[model samples]
Target: MLEKVRYEGAYPTREKADEAVRLVLSGLGRQLTGDERVDLAARLPWEAARGLTAQIPDTRQLTGWAFVKDLAARTNASLATTRWDTGSVFAAVAAHAGPDLLTRILHQLPTGYALLFGRAELTQAA
Candidate 1:
């Protein structure tokens, strides 16, 4: 996981990549619930899974912008950097989740999550 994050984020050190992975996963944990969450945790390595399972989750779900804003505040990082970290970490995660599970996860979250996971959000013309 750290390797993927490091490669995707171009982090200078393993620690930096690890931090990004943990922060992104923890934020996502707050947003994911039910069987999809459990299934994802099961799919990941134990340490990564713990990051996803550890959060208690907020009662109200946050939009993707809000999620990034919250993470930026928590890390004292700039929004651009936080957004990059989220994208890098989620790119790794989306690879792990594959198309099907990722589709389920994106469905559960609010708008903008698909792009966060490195997938486009498409709408059918009416």
Candidate 2:
């Protein structure tokens, strides 16, 4: 059952960002180890998530902007401008079955999980 969660524009609270990240991490199978997950999960600025997301592999394959553009068209939210960041992508699906569908995403997202997790950009925290 997919409950309707609102995409509240930009997250004004860390809780919101955290929830979104949790959802995405869960969705991505948390492919990262506990330490890696901890590092990514730690409190940081939105811009930092962008940089980190860009570093993650298979992320390049993620058509975040396009997905949001499509989602906006389907929903009342007119999110015309595609924000090319992980949080934005997470927010895109937060309203649907994201957090709940972690298992499925885990199997689907990782083309080569090592490629992403091993990257210095993703592992090197600020």
In model 2, the worst 10-residue window by lDDT is 113-122
TM-score of each candidate structure, all chains considered together: 0.96, 0.24
Error of 2 at 70 (Å): 14
Runs in model 1 with CA error above 4 Å?
124-126
lDDT of 2 at 21: 47
Cα-lDDT of candidate 1:
0.91
lDDT of 2 by residue, 14-121 (tens): 565554444444434323333433344343345434433443443333333444444345334446432222345343343232343433333344343222222222
Where model 2 places Cα greater than 4 Å from the true spot, the runs are 1-10, 30-126
What is model 2's C-alpha RMSD? 13.0
User: Top TM-score: which candidate number?
Assistant: 1
